[model samples]
Target: MTEVLLEAQSLKKHFPVTAGFILARTVSSIKAVDGVSFIIRQGETLSLVGESGCGKTTTAKMILLLEDPTMGSILFRGKDLQRLTPAEMKEYRASVQAVFQDPWSSLNPRLRVGSIIGEPLVVNRALPSKAIQEQVRELLLQVGLRPDHDDLYPHEFSGGQRQRIAIARALSLKPALIVLDEPVSALDVSIRAQIMNLLKDLQHQYGLGYLLIAHNLATVRYMSHRVAVMYLGKIVETAQTKQLFSHPQHPYTRALISAALRSRPDTQDEEIVLPGEVPSPLDPPPGCSFHPRCSNALPLCSKTTPVPREQERGHWVACHLAETLTVATRATISAEERP
Candidate 1:
């Protein structure tokens, strides 16, 4: 069995709304990440997939310790992050890194690529000036960029090149875990594949664990070892990539897969369009938050929130009808397989 590198137990992040000028009375809160829990095994990639505003980004931020959790705990290698002191937190920062969505916005426009990548070493005072330059050059080459290209500014590089520079910088400290928040979403489709391949190669080479937060199911399918599907502010389903794709028990997961299947021009499948827009987090639906949009919703689904339960080996789903759905799905697959 693989050792767990990072574990989140009911991790929650809520943003408070304030009203009034002088008193600043607190209004309702927006529960961005409400009770999310998962474990990332060492050298494995866990992809969190969902629609926009579904708390994927919020969860990523919490893992990076950028956004403090409103409730619950984050344990990295059995050490609770909230217990770290100011200086210890600084050291912790060096062990975790992030690659944001937009390469253009993340990179410093004025600084040369070498300086940007070397900044982490300078901040930690880890190496001499000459060594910093050498390390930066080596990192650039590792990410498939020419070592000499390090002297060029961000504007001189293309979008893919800029993202490579960003990735090289993130790897400068040799972090154990990386939180990739839609790392390839902003790039061109052609360029996306190259970055994905690079990420895969890097993970194999370094034994790095990753928390990949993205809305693209296709991309998630290609890169993830395991996948967690989120809706509103909660995780609705989680399973190994092949298991989730083959037998998605949750209604939301089924819809997402249907959508992905429909995207292919050769597919003659019907799309599963959910009714109504996502409800506001501040005023989430009572009982099951997803009941309003779920196609197979029942009376109990609206009156009682379903907790995640194991439906099969290593597969967990949060839904009142998951067992029934699993049987129905198997019957359907059996029918399709008939000659």
Candidate 2:
């Protein structure tokens, strides 16, 4: 079995909604990440997929320690992050890194590529200048960038190159886990594949665990070992990539897959369009939050929240009708989705 690098148990993040600027009071709370739980094992990619504002980003933020969770715990190799000593906290910081959506904003415009890449080393390691420069060059080479490009400013590089630079910086600290928040979404279509391939190669080389946050199903399909589909601050479904793509059990999961499949060439699958807008997090609907948009929602769905069940081996679904839906969706899928 692979080593578990990080684990999150029932993580939740709620933002307070205040009213009356003069005498502000807590009006309500926006449950951004109501209760998310998953684990990333060595060299494995676990993707968290959802529509915008579904709390995937907030979940990522909690993992990165950028925002404190309102409830629940984050553990790094069975150690609770909140209880870490100062030295352990520093070590944790060095072990974890992030690659954000936009490379243009992520990179420092004024700094040369070398400085940007080597900054982590300078902060975390007491290495000499020459050693740091050598390390920077090697990282650039590893990412398919020329060694001499390090002296150039960010503006001189194209978007793809900048993203590669951002990746190099993320790799600088030799992190055990990297949270990729839509890392390739902002790149050109052609460049996206190259970056994704590079990331895959790096993961193999370093045995690095990845927590990928992405909206592109194509990218997710190519990169992830397992995927967790989030809906209204909760994970509605989770399974191995091939299993989820081939046999999604929840209504929302099936809908997402059907939509993605419809876009492929010669695909005849109909898109599942949900009704109504996503309800406000501040005032989420009762029971199953997705019930308002679910076409096959039962009366039980509106009155009682469903507990997540292991509907199949390694496949979990949170829905009142997952069992019935499983039988209905057992038809053969496209060859592309086969394990």
Candidate 3:
């Protein structure tokens, strides 16, 4: 059995809205991540897929210890992160790292590529300056950058090259887990595949666990071992990548899959356009958060929030009508495709 590297239980991050003059009191809160739970196994990549404003980034931030959780806990290697003190938290930072979305914004324009990659090592005081330089050179080579390019600044490299430097910097800490927050979203289409392949190789070489957060299902499909689909601020479905793609249970999952399939001509032509806007987190509707936009929503969907239940082996879904609704949807699609 694969060992669990990171486990987040009922993690919630709610930013309070205070409205007053000098003495401010909390009025309401914006629930960015609400009760999200998942496990990342050692040497496995778990991709979190969701639309924009779905709290995926916030969840990643919490896992990386960048933001404190308002409720619940994050356990790394069976140790509760919230229970740790400032000194321990600083130590924990060495074991966990992050790769942000924009490469241009992530790297310092004034710093050379070598210093940027070696900065973490220097800050952590993990190695001597000579050893750090050698490590930086090796990391650059590992990420497909030439050793001679290390002296150049951020502007000297292309967008993809800058991202490679960002990745190299993340790996410098020798982290056990890395939260990849849309690492390739800013790269060109042609360079994206190369970067993805590099990431896969690095994971294999280092046995690194990843929490890959992205909105692109296709990219997630290629990179992830397990996939979690999120809507609003909650996870609606989670399963092995192959199983999720083959048998999506939640309505939101089905819609996302339908959209992904539509983008590929060889898959299918039908597109499932989810109607209605996503409700505001500040004023979310009662009951199921996705019920307002779900096509097959029933009366119970608006009355009670469905807890995530395992309908199949290693497959969990949070929907009142997952079983019946999924079957009906498959049948409808099959009938439409028949000659």
Q: Between candidates 1 and 3, name the one with more favorable TM-score.
A: 1
State residue 213's C-alpha deviation in candidate 2, in Å. Answer: 0.7
Q: Write the per-residue lDDT of candidate 3 for residues 1-339, one digit (tens) a residue.
A: 878999999999999999998999999999889999999998999999988888999999888767889999999888898788888788789988998889989899999888999999999976889999999999999999998888899999898988999999999988989899998888999999999999999999989999999988889999999999988889999999999998889988888888775464576655789897788899887889998888788899899999999989889999999888868877998998999
TM-score ranking, high to low? 1, 2, 3
* Model 1 poorest ten-residue lDDT run: 261-270
lDDT of 2 at 165: 94
- What's model 2's overall lDDT? 0.92
lDDT (0 to 1) per candidate:
0.90, 0.92, 0.90
Cand. 1 Cα-lDDT: 0.90
Tens digits of lDDT, candidate 1, 140-178: 999999999988899998889888999999999998888
lDDT of 1 at 296: 84
TM-score against truth, every candidate:
0.96, 0.96, 0.95
Writing each residue's lDDT as its tens digit, candidate 2 over 62-151 gives 989999999999999899999999999999999999999999899988899999999999999999999999999999999999999999
TM-score (C-alpha) between model 3 and the true structure: 0.95
lDDT of 3: 0.90
lDDT, candidate 1, residue 274? 80
Error of 3 at 315 (Å): 0.6
